[model samples]
Target: MNLQPDARRALGAGLVVIALVAFSNSSAHISDVGQQAAVAAVSSTDTLTQLNQSLISANKDKGVLKEGELLEKAVHRKALMEILAKENPAHFLRYVLNASQISSLPKSVTATVEKRISTEGVIDTYIIDDFEHPEKSHYEYYFKRGANVKSLYLVGDLLVRSNTQALITGYEGDTYVVADNTKGNVTIKANKDIDGGSNEALGVQNTAVILVDFDDSGPRPFTKEQAKNIFFNAQFNKFMKEQSYNKVSFKGDVYGWYRLSGPSMSNGQHVIPVFGNDNSQLNRIILENNIPIGNYGRVIIAINSDFTSSSQVGMTMQYIGGREYFFSSSWISLAGFDILAPFPFTWTDLDFLLAHELGHALGLMHANSWECG
Candidate 1:
């Protein structure tokens, strides 16, 4: 998430740098004039274009960018959108679905649907799919039944993009999308959610944290003790305790530096072998070695590999004999050892990485606050 020159200019001269310096120095003060300048600068289409271009460029260079850098860039992009929408409503509305259009969506169609807006301002629609009973189409019955259901599925949203009023529905890779106004049947292609039980996240959570490396990879830079500290240290533990009001806290054992069979290098570049979305092979190896995975409520797999793509650095799902687990993989170079290292930026630490993915494993979703002002 290297901020391009164009994006820096769009944000007004030196605002990003000043803000970063302030954050690093623990300074809370930002002049009112500076805030006004940022708002004014972001209210133009040129700023939006520059920010969008920066994101595109960042995506192309994701292999070189750390997860924290990517996250910072995303946050910047979202902030720019929020400011622009608030300062220039008429201009912003030209790109996204407006109140009238959002309200006009058929109640029957939206009855069991959940809608979310992306940072790019596109509306994404998700529908619930029941795995136990394939005949059931809507999500209401399961909602009313509480946590009694054995199997439930939540498919990723149907991304709807439009320049005009027409709505079209289709599939974007595994997830569905709507592109035009024609009413049609949606065929679910991806299962984004698999619920073993809704109440699994409550009370004390016992986790099994496994660190893995590809067979051809080097020794893990961090030791088992360092990895254990990430989850059990006072900072993370206190934060979790406060957030859940002491109702939820984790007790976990760290295991591994386990080597999974895979070609660490592909085409002169390092690669991590992942079977589709979840690392089924890693799960299989753990089970085969008699790791007692079923005893814990959650499992966290930290891979010693840096992600080449920006789509996902961590993911969570119910798998491995229908047990809940999350896979978190990010490169932590030797230089990234500083507790407050600024090179990889913030939120790249093993603590943050595990906690973030663990949030997903606990049924939490990414926070979204951008809305039309």
Candidate 2:
């Protein structure tokens, strides 16, 4: 799949960085996002275009229609329609369904959703068939359901533009959370003291948050010199300790400082540092039609920074619980307290911030979702 620089740029810049790669173009099946370009060939055929037109004519809702053909070509029709009517048009459909949502989706659909989410931010379609390959497409995104699957949705009302891409700017969708009950009693450990309150503190009984200490070996925006002090500072230590408490006191499991960095991180995905391995490493296998992470209960958590401004002193949450973290930038935001607090722009509230988002990661929607409910 020799993606034209334009295509790669298009992918990196498009609201959804969909890799319209190459494949054998058989009876149309799902495809992976990665491959040797020369081996696979993308469809130049107007099949997607035709499909797009058909959907628009059939479903005229503004959100659906406004998304245009790109969506139809990239995702599934049913999912897009739902996102349009419920997420875009501001119509609450889940209220009619009465089902609690999960935070991560299946690996297959999630892969495609992540691609769209990486660029556009919100997903309305699933990548089912990949004309690029007989067995796969450049990627696959679709929605499927099962009794054993845990589904999560995130909804927000904002928009974001990253790397010249147009994102809906908020989050509103669902994911799957496989309860870690396989271990009979899952142990959650943290690195610091436990406050024993709040949802995060209470969640300690079934989860864990690791307190990490590193010499700054992985990915980050701040240079080594700038981040050195905070790495081992007392406040940082206290934070980690508290994080440990949050995990252990709450019966959560924690793995000490681990390493994370790969294409996604290099591509500008700002994930946080944690102790154990969520096997997010599998995410690096973009076009394989396989997912190593996003299993049943284990959700990947990353610590992001609020470097939007120098004065800004808070933590930002990246809920990759979706194929990507947020649907649109507006789906989540840093609270005012994070900014006004006396923390540095570094990982000051990494643990606490993670705690807040972990709540969302754990199938707990905001109080607002109840209103929406």
Candidate 3:
């Protein structure tokens, strides 16, 4: 989706940069602050007007929605946001439920998540949704379940986003370990550490993923230079060995890295990395381009740095896991941490972030305290 340069700048500045704590080989926790958007809140009426204009532009560009129909939907969405805000507003980790889907869901879940969803966890009731899409509005995020036959509600995202300190929660096969105890807090621990191919990890196991980025001529977010240092650094590989009590060491070669340029990384709806196991647009592109897929895991990392052409959500990573490491992968921003961090940052912090996420992908759950239980 193309965004005008001016508009991207305007929104990116306000999009919250959620800074989270990355764990060590063990899920060591810490007191951390989310790098939230610094913009001042505008009146709801004015905010709705801007949203309405954007909705109109998006619909007109997509050439979808009947005359005034998109506006009606936007009005409904704005109203829903208001109602949801009253229920609990304070937007961060922004989310909005599909009105239609909500009605259809079993009463048990709708009752639970509807009451729990919010933007910033202030119980301020602010939630967000991309309702302009004719069919695939962001509101209806879903993932495949048994036998990969169909997509089911990623109700977990809603549940976690809606509630606080949501730890040890698993949906489908993926688990949510909000180890840090903060809103938008996430850590991935997969059980496939010991058995690289097994869906779950017995002890400490080995896992692999294809981490790639677009070869944009502009500055890179995480340069191949920087990625190599993080991925192949003596300490990084050493850290992996240490994670398994020196049993499962990645002497290198556990993951492959590539950079692609051109339209392959351009098509498809943008995917915001999340804690669930949904295949992203870049993953599809990788498949079409014949990138080898892993048996135990499959994911293509696309480092999107084009603020002028991208929707700016702070740094995020997504995975799909059930059992042990059925399939898990992630896409991360090049400069998300650098841009979001309030303190001076370096690769060490970034390395820990990777380590922490790996811990989650391998089936570990978060602890209420500083430990990874």
Poorest lDDT segment (10 consecutive residues) of candidate 2: 307-316
Q: On residues 157-251, what C-alpha lDDT tens digit does candidate 3 reach at each position?
A: 33111111212222211211111123333332221222232323222233333454455425444544555455555453465454343433332
Off by over 4 Å in 1: 1-197, 265-280, 308-348, 370-373
lDDT of 1 by residue, 134-155 (tens): 2231211010011112111112
Instruction: Quote the positional error of residue 235 for candidate 1 in Å.
Output: 2.1
How many clashes does each candidate structure show, in the order listed? 7, 84, 40
State the lDDT at 206 in candidate 3: 33
lDDT of 2 by residue, 51-77 (tens): 445443434343434344434443563
TM-score of 1: 0.41
Off by over 4 Å in 3: 1-199, 202-206, 209-211, 214-233, 251-280, 298-325, 332-350, 365-368, 371-373
Off by over 4 Å in 2: 1-204, 210-249, 261-348, 361-363, 368-373
Per-model CA lDDT versus the true structure: 0.40, 0.26, 0.33
Ranking by lDDT: 1, 3, 2
Instruction: Give candidate 3's whole-model lDDT.
Output: 0.33
Most TM-score-accurate candidate = 1
Candidate 1 clashing pairs, residues 3+ apart or interchain:
158-176, 166-181, 167-180, 167-181, 168-178, 168-179, 168-180
